[model samples]
Target: MEISFVRIDDRLIHGQVATIWTKTSKCNRIMACSDEVAKDDLRKTLLLQVAPPEIKAYVLTIDKAIDAYKNPKYDSFKTLFLFTNPKDVVRMVKAGVPIKSVNVGGMCYKEGKIQITSAVSVSEEDIDAFKTLNEKGIELELRQVASENKVSLMSRLDSLKLI
Candidate 1:
């Protein structure tokens, strides 16, 4: 399977994704891997509906996504993986999904989370997961759109911690 892009955006299939990132990634399929989102039928339908017409999209559990990635039938798939949180991405990586990099996108501020970038915020668990990804040599970049320059998420986190 060719991983065209991997993004962590809380709003899994929003306007920016359906209109911008999908085209930028050049992926034929988009898999939103999140156990919580997978269980919500309404949310799944909404996400699937927003996907661009030419590209297929699936809201799947992390395990199901791993299975699909390993399945020979999907070997020709050029996939763009989407996640709502760093923990889910960590799960996919631990399950042997060969993700080389992750784009940290719009992670909106919520209670108990510290703002990392204007568009991103991190909880303690998120920080730990990000650190793990960094330690594993995976590139973690922050970019709201395809046109913007990529910023190192770890560097931003480190600078924030120092402040």
Candidate 2:
């Protein structure tokens, strides 16, 4: 599978993803990789249902996603990968998925997390995962929509003294 785009959005397959990012990436498939979601039949079905008719969708566990990504049968698939958190991204990357960059789309507000951008909030664990991705040469970009200018997430973290 050719991963055309990788985004970390807490709300997996929402409006912005269904419209903007999908068109921007020109991906034919939307793969939401999360162990939690994959285990929930209702959520998995809901996510798959929301995808545009022209595009194929799959909600797979991290291990399954990694296997599919490495499998030759999926070589023709142009996929846009979505994860709920940076920790999952790190897991895939560490498992040897060749992700060159990742979009930090929306992390949302959580009890202990600090707002990094209007759309992103991160806790210490998220910060460490992002730092790990950065160290591995993965470019972390921050943008809520396709039309917006991409911001370097690491730079912002540095400027904010969060890392």
Q: Pick the lDDT winner.
A: 2
Please report the TM-score between candidate 2 and the true structure.
0.98
TM-score of each: 0.97, 0.98
lDDT of 2 by residue, 1-163 (tens): 8889999998999888998889999999999999999999999888888898899999999999999999999999999999999999999999999999999999999899999899999999999999999999999999999899999999999999998
Q: Candidate 2 local accuracy as lDDT?
A: 0.95
Give residue 66's lDDT in candidate 1 (0 to 100).
98
Candidate 1: stretches off by over 4 Å: none
> Residue by residue across 1-163, what tens digits does model 1's lDDT show?
8999999999999899999998898999999999999999999999999999999999999999999999999988899999999999999899998899999998989999998788998899999999989888999999999999999999898888722
